[model samples]
Target: MKPETPFYITTPIYYPNAEPHLGHAYTTVFADILARYHRLIGDDTFYLTGTDEHGLKLQRAAEAKGVTPKEFVDSMVAIYRNFWGLLNISYNRFVRTTDEDHIKVVKYAAEVMYRKGLIYKGNYSGWYCVDCEKFYSASEYLMIDGRPHCPIHRKPLEWTEESTYYFRLSEFREYLLNLLKNKDIVYPKHFRQEVINKIVGQELLDISIARPKERVWWGIELPFDKNYTVYVWFDALLNYLTGINYLSDKERFRRYWSSTHHVIGKDILWFHTAVWFAMLKALDIDPPKKVLVHSFIINKGLKMGKSSGNAVRIEDLLGRYLSSDGVRYLIARIFNLGKDVEVSTSLLDSIYNSELADNLGNLIRRVGVLIKKKLKGTLSSESIDNTLTDKADTAVHKFNKLLGEEYEISTALQEVMGLLKEANAYINSVRPWELSDPSKELYTLMEVVKVAINLLYPVIPESVSKVAESFSIQLGNPLDISVDVGKEYVVKEAPILFKKVR
Candidate 1:
């Protein structure tokens, strides 16, 4: 068999009905970090994130704002782009369902199923949540706060009726079961198990796949019939493939599609891992290779949503915390991969001060400060002793093996911080501050400090550049990342790298 090629990953296309929130921001940033890492490590990686701009949600949001659905969705998509930009989310492609290529792919997908008799004209009358853009089963409606609420969005469910087209999802029960049996379908093992227990273990129901154009005209029109538009999920999910022109760009798609990983909040896991797999199998296409399911971000132990009026806006975090890496690090380190994690201002402050400032930042300041002290503010090439090279090599090897090879990001970050801790301990033990003649061992201390900055660059990118300035080293590209301690050395000492915020 040919060697499996490179890695690709994506955040779920977000609904553009509301302002961006931390719940949404957290997902994209985590995906961005993984994408950045894969690209840095030389994978032919593709990272896509964008807005899903169709469905009842868009229609209703437009009505509330006294505008056309197009205007409403356009404004919402802009918020998503700006908010993500603030977070430094490096998305390779910001695909929109409204994009012509995406529209064509969704139509093509619908046509294929229509030809197979897998789509049928049907009546859909049920409790719909405009916020979720989904119809809830009778069992799913909640009576919390003395009202029938959407379990996912916690808003009152609306009653509606209309003629629609439905995908013969029941027809794919066996196909989904067989696909789930294939272990490579979704990754990290635990996430796959959740899909099995929840999606496959439950009876598959035929899904409503198109909306009557009269009711909601914001989506791609079904090619088989012009009276209806494809369901928002049907149209939006295809952006993953259509973003790369999966059908049109055969060779290109073949390279990245199978290695693709979709990082989504648990709310949409069914659509991504299950329904997406069924659709691909029906079209004789490969399903996304992995789905990394994440739980929600709660605030003060309560779920945050629009109606709750407590949604933590993305701008709030970015504005208050100039600590961009600090927020990213806190989310990645504290979140339990497959379980809900809470967020609060206090929690954010704690992680910023405790992890980034006290730990990583303090380490950088100490080493760079000491280097400037001994070398008289100009780094010396001979300030590094060759004897300490082995220890540096061993530490970097252990971290790279865990982070790059094993996909253990949380463990990897912990290990990266461990390297910083070791360096701080080295400085304390060597007491370079006490060195008057500054012997060969002082150079050994410089070598150790230099190695710590190189290894920590991938996680805290900005700080690395500053640390490089102090060492008189010019890092070519952060993406051209290097963890090799013995590779090359540039020793020119400058000032301390971090200034702690009061």
Candidate 2:
């Protein structure tokens, strides 16, 4: 079936001031899973992920490393690409803010906003959170250790006075509040409420959108002003447009941007739902179709970060897992939508050993072995028990409804695990290996196992491929619960899908 409507998804362009961590991997993995699910269901899907290379953070880090900002970003971009490649992220485009086309579109957006009287020159005097790269109003600043600090960054704020251009965010407060409350603009009602309280419950400030060249020399120069550069957030957000070449390719942009979904961490939820949405409205473009905000990955009960000294690198964690598929599976299983998940070596180890190796993988190994020994590596047609058929149908329906519409992955995996348990129980009850005439029981077992592998493919594509190949089966639409081992097929000798680890 051809895709009916395009599903364009984006993971927040990670700020590459540091290496990619488990927190970063969580967002990208979630986006990849959603993209893959959409693709399997026959949606024309496009996934965009990349680096935000221009910011005070990038500039400061570059200067500290004694390299130009451009050179630093170039090297960091390579690291990001390598990491995503290792994890098998199937994004259609990896955008960089420094790209020529991105700069062009950012300038275009700024010019259009400026002409509409939505941007103006102003002097900003407030607590500047260098870590967040945004200014906090007096009321928004938190007092810590008797000094004003940024609530999000937990760092002392710098009192700065600078003349910069500000975007009229206050003008869109009502529009943003209505958008959040009335539309399916953000997912998981609680997160939407968080935005509503911020916009409607309080004042929305006019955000500064430019930094003087003398202060920050590593961003897109404003089209109307030569002495200033676009703020990093402003420049970074344009990638969603430039990633699809919005300015030059109207058709491509329309096809993808018509229904855009953003996957971002909760820390930046306000930026997407408020600042970015307001910018789009100011530019006369439609707001994104939906926003999925995820909670941070924590370590030792603290959010993982370099400053926290608890950051877990993706590469280090990948080493313990047998394959990238295993790593992705555990992360998707570990993270719950809209809530924090603590990361640890032992946690992943246990989940992988019990779920993948012991439960799912063990079932696959048992099925392959039974078919090879009892049926002489050949499968014959048999009547599937109604009990097994109903189970398969229910699993497929729930998996589709949960993962597809509700975005409840953890629950979907629970459904898959339930089916796996049923398969195990069915195998135990029939004792196919011991029965003198075991064709029907073995055939039914294979069908159950086939459907389980199809459902697991979105989370662990590569590993599931091995399972499918071993049984001479082509993995198709996960929603297709039909048992398709065919009338008589030869099964290949198979290795354990996941090796048991201590």
Candidate 3:
């Protein structure tokens, strides 16, 4: 079905310098869930996720492996795609920064900025991290063992000086302040204040947007200058626009760009907001509709990163959970946009065994067995219990509010799980097993299950699809769900969606 309203969301094109980890899965899965939700509501949705291939880190990593940068990323991109496929990421486009179209778009934008005096040649010297591909000032870098270190990697920073080009990021200080204050561009409200505080306390200096080819040759070169390549960060940021065909397909770009939501981690908040918005302003384009920032998933008392070596492998998660849906459910349950989530295997096991296997899975199994044994696998329309109906209605309302308005995915899952719990208790109390004609009770329970499953479909799609098929439920728009109980249902064999781990 063709959707009427356009909705677009993007995950930060990940740096594919190494194998993907839980940190990468966390962000991509969250974006996938959001994209699924929008599609569920009949919105035209486009999801973009890809690899950030051009950078000093990739170049160095490739050199260590005795392969060209292109050869290395070519192999790494396959791994990323396979991992995303395993997790069931439903992205419409997986854009690579090394793609010819992306490179052209970067050069085109750079040329335009230079022509309009928004970009100029300049000399820059600062402490830089090859891993992060950005400069850190005195206040931003951490003092570690009497040396300045990259806060994220906790590695020693290199002091480098070069003649480069700078983007006039400083010129839009007042504009950014007003935009942040007046518009609902950033999510969780507090993140907005954090950016505002930074702007108020410090200066927005013109950012260096080019690197000398002698230092970093694996990047998009400047259109006007052959001696320099566009900074990796600057080139990377343009993938968002390139993914949407900003230069090639203007009409399509306008449609999706108007409702664009860039999903990112808090570490890059300044770049996405302070730098990105100004770049758009220079291009005479409107800022993205929302920059949804999420806090990191912490493991072992530190942010999970490949460099940190505390990162959880995606294979380990899949091996433990036994399915993509299981991993997806765990991520959705712990998803947080405001605060860092400290994660462990025990936490993942508890949520899976208690919620998916015990509560939701147990209810489906019991209900399916009783309905098949008693009603011979067919049920006619009947009046649903008002108490259960009211609970389902309330859960749906709160789920929509939390997910659609507040972007609180964890709370939204809780609301649906709460409804499932209520249904489980309702079944135990009603005891449909004892009664000979338990159609009414069973019907009520199934209605409640339908509501819960629809709400959860965005998170655990595979499990939800299985339950939907067994229970004869049409997984339609969640908003269309009500407890009217007007249709007939055919119960097939009961399926165990999630088996308890140990």
State each model's CA lDDT, in order. Answer: 0.71, 0.85, 0.90
Best-to-worst lDDT order: 3, 2, 1
The per-residue C-alpha lDDT of model 2 at residue 343 equals: 68
Model 3 pairs in collision = none
- Cα lDDT tens digits for candidate 3, 369-470: 999999999976567788988999999889988998788999999888888898899999999889989888889888898889999998999999999999
Count of backbone clashes, every candidate in sequence: 2, 0, 0
Q: Model 2 — which ten-residue stretch has the worst lDDT?
A: 300-309
Find the candidate with the highest TM-score and give its number. Answer: 3
Superposition error at 490 for model 1 (Å): 5.5
lDDT of 2 by residue, 247-291 (tens): 999998989998799998898988888999999999888999989
How much is 133 displaced in model 2, in angstroms? 11
lDDT of 1 at 52: 88
RMSD of each: 4.2, 3.1, 3.0
Q: What local lDDT does model 3 show for residue 222? A: 95
